[model samples]
Target: MKPSYPLMLTALFGLFALTGCGVVAPGLAAAPPTPVPKTHHSAAKQKPRTPSPVTVPRPTSGNELGVVPILEYHMIGPTEGRWQRTPQGLYQDLTWLYDHGFALVTMQQYESGDMNLPAGKHPAVLTFDDGDYSQFEWNSAHVPLPTSAVGVLEAFQKAHPDFPVTATFYLNNHPFGVDSVAKMQWLVAHGFELGNHTYTHADMSSLDASGIEKEIGEEQAYIEQSVPGYVPVSFALPYGGLPQDPTDRTAVLNGSYQGISWHFLGVALVGANPAPSPYSKTFSVSIPRIQVVDPSLVASSTRYYILSGYEAQFLQDPSMLYTSDGSPKWISFPQNLSAQLNPAYSSRANPEQ
Candidate 1:
């Protein structure tokens, strides 16, 4: 075997290098690929999801009318008087109403029949008399005082988050103390209602028709001018006094002075009674208010009687209440109570097929 030395050396080096580096020679065939096992398929499939059913209260039927309780509050401060309520007391009142599923509505809403509350909710009105400085007051820095009624309400609103923060303030000559005009504007701007309590807050019953005009008309003009866009639609009778004469009532109802006029929709008296439903015939002119006076006064008078006796019961049992359901305004109540309510308020009845 005679081979060239240099060629033999080069070939041997190449073979050794290939073997050391784990490389296949050019002439060698590649290794065969490994076989993969097949996976088994399942016959079962996933079922589609069914949507959740909408939750609504059981449908009620009848004509039983719901009674709305309008609570009347006077001064909101630390004063110890039957007509005044402490800030803590005001908070307690609001808390009780809110906890009992009562939605705070304005007198205007009550008058205009805007009583559309969500399901399982009742409407109640909070009214403050005299437009007392303690009812709504600001510090020297122009901030609401903690003891003020509005301050308590706003603070409560923040804490509860879902409670309706609204009320009506019956104003005489002064609104929320100093800077009366600014306070009036503040109330209107912040969704609060301003109502006339007469200019002098005098005994409206003793006043003649002209005197009533001066008291009411002048205040109306002042409020109109002060607030720019506010026109008080509701009125609270001064000292709960009403003019007995039909003529006097008419004048108070629609009186004009200084080119300004008052067309009061709802007139509140000093009496302690629950306001009839705005649907009632007597609701427009003689709306009654439940006074939130001293506990001693409650014992002496029946200020809390209507709400405690009747309205509270209605809230506890929706079957005894009349509320408009979406279309056709179906007033809901138990069928057995149909005799208790007026026929006009009842939902349409279907005859047997």
Candidate 2:
């Protein structure tokens, strides 16, 4: 069996302390409480079995924890410069997902006032980080392969218009140039969401609160300035990282950006990731992320993305939810509304057994 993460952390801390003191301390024998099992989710009843369903706990409040996919992406293009993905590869990936049981959703669909998810299911949000100009060209250019992420997204949108599909681009102020801002504005006008990526892609955590705000908010202000009324509310931490706890690290221009996208916002990294996304789950401090490594990885991994949402909850729920057979151990919540988790959102890492 895999050792618990808390235990490992404790052991590591103990070792560090021991190294300093050169002896075991008194009253250090006691261990912390085991995390409560996420009850609301599981593939089977209590018993030994494979760890299939991600141990994401069901949200205590259904309305706060809406079921949906927030798919993250970066440079989706042919250039193999680490972040780019090919157009043909991207299309194949999307086509497979659409053909399967999945439906691409918009952040708007996730808001409780708009639409509710069915029981045991939630809509997925598609996101792009770095604001690469390549995204817009997908529509205009007719390159041999789909040429860009935007091109395939348009293809998917056309194929499934009412599927509630929309993409959020976390615009980077410095690296990527402007010609696409107008196109970005246009996308937002058509129900697509726009979000902030940071003016210079600097580390928000490294700065003081004011400095952080300026770092995050300035770019947002710039985007709005470039394209009248262009505000990208949602936030994607630069370098896929975020600020400290309870830190309000957002810059809402057109709309409020309370929601966050996980790091690098990649395609393969989005397996139905339950909340407390694999990146961070501290609620306040955790800036979620999905690594957009490349096209091959994206093409191979869809089930992981779909299941990630359910699993994210499973990992957080203290109930230790599981099934008798343990196939689809998801913590069920009322559709449409998102719920809060119990025991507080943990900032430290917790390992699953």
Candidate 1 structure lDDT: 0.65
Best by lDDT: 1
lDDT string for model 1 (151-260, tens) is 99889888988876889988888666688988888888888899988887766668788888888998898889889978998887765556655567666767997688
> Model 1: how far is 211 from its true place, Å?
1.6
Per-residue accuracy of model 2 over 1-353 as CA lDDT, tens digit each: 11134423432343234334533222211112123234545645557667686555533332223323445555655554334556775665566456533445443333211333343233345677676666665223433124656667766677777555566676667423445656665676766766666677665446555666566556666776666865443555554333443233322111222232222112111112333321111222222233333434333433233323334443475232211111122333333212233233233212222
TM-scores of the models, in the order given: 0.73, 0.53
Clash number by candidate, in order: 1, 70
**Cα lDDT computed for each candidate against the true fold:** 0.65, 0.43
RMSD of each: 37.9, 15.2
Q: Tell me, by TM-score, which candidate is best.
A: 1
Report the number of backbone clashes for model 2. 70
